[model samples]
Target: MRTFLTLFIALTLGLGWGLAARAEGFLGVYEDLPLAPGLTEVEGSGLSFDSPGGRIVEGYATGAVEAAEILKFYAATLPQLGWARDSDTLYRREAEVLKIDTEVDGGALAVHFTISPE
Candidate 1:
């Protein structure tokens, strides 16, 4: 009984931690937004606000990965999160729009993400 209790507690804690980590967003910018793998958030580049209209957010991330890979990641991931692709780099969900843009920076790709009221 003692061994079973300890195992149960450990499993519960481990599951909670795993869920929290999975739900965390890039740079802590937006709670519901997902970050692409192999990218790191740009320091001091996140912006977020809530106005009467709605919420707005912007942030940047950089990675050594190819632009196509990043695009593919979002393309496959965003729709599952309720965002419908509006274009190659734009997505929409309910009352907001999410746009993704990338630029080559010193052999790395700099990704700019913006969320605004639709």
Candidate 2:
């Protein structure tokens, strides 16, 4: 009985740790910008800098997901993160604008994400 209880405690801690890590966002692309599931960041495709205006970030990710699904995901998700949908591919927050562009690359969909000062 003691051994079974110990095992359960260990599993519970492990599951909680996993969930916390997953909530930290994928790829570390941009803070508060959620990467859609099934997409992975492209190597050496991230750029970030701070200008007099504000910060700018650019990155790319690729996945096998459909374009419509990607769009739908962001439309539903971004607002929850304080981003307002300005258009089908653009979102605006307090002082920044995020632009998302996707294209078919080989057999995968490549997404380019850009965030700039508004």
Candidate 3:
């Protein structure tokens, strides 16, 4: 049991560190998106950065890979990052897009996106 406990703690710490490491600008923002339910499309307002502004996209869904913006936000914001789709679990969301249970192909949350340095 000691070994198992040690492994568990290590795994937990690793996961936290991973999340923190990925937490930059928008990626960190996306990570904090709430998961509730009754979502169909993206919602949110834009902000200023360059000339016009960057619109904060928000989408709501329950247990389905609906919007790609939320995941893409992290993927594009992170280096060589991307998200997957979760067809196995149902997700409910509120406020921002919730990166739900995604396949472990890349990251824990199937973000379903691509990171571009542009």
Kindly give the stretch of ten consecutive residues in candidate 1 with the minimal lDDT sum.
Answer: 17-26
Ranking of candidates on TM-score, top first: 2, 1, 3
TM-score of each: 0.76, 0.77, 0.19
- lDDT tens readout by residue for model 3, 34-107: 23222222233212122233224333322343345434433432222222323323222222122233333332
- TM-score (C-alpha) between model 2 and the true structure: 0.77
Task: Quote the positional error of residue 45 for candidate 2 in Å.
Answer: 1.1
Backbone clashes for every candidate come to: 0, 0, 16
Compared with the true structure, what per-residue lDDT tens digits does model 1 show for residues 71-117? 87788766756689988799998899999999999999999999999
Instruction: Give the alpha-carbon lDDT of every model.
Output: 0.76, 0.75, 0.31
Q: How far is candidate 2 from the true structure (C-alpha RMSD, Å)?
A: 9.7
Q: What residue runs in model 2 are displaced by over 4 Å at the alpha carbon?
A: 1-24
Which has the higher TM-score value, candidate number 2 or candidate number 3?
2
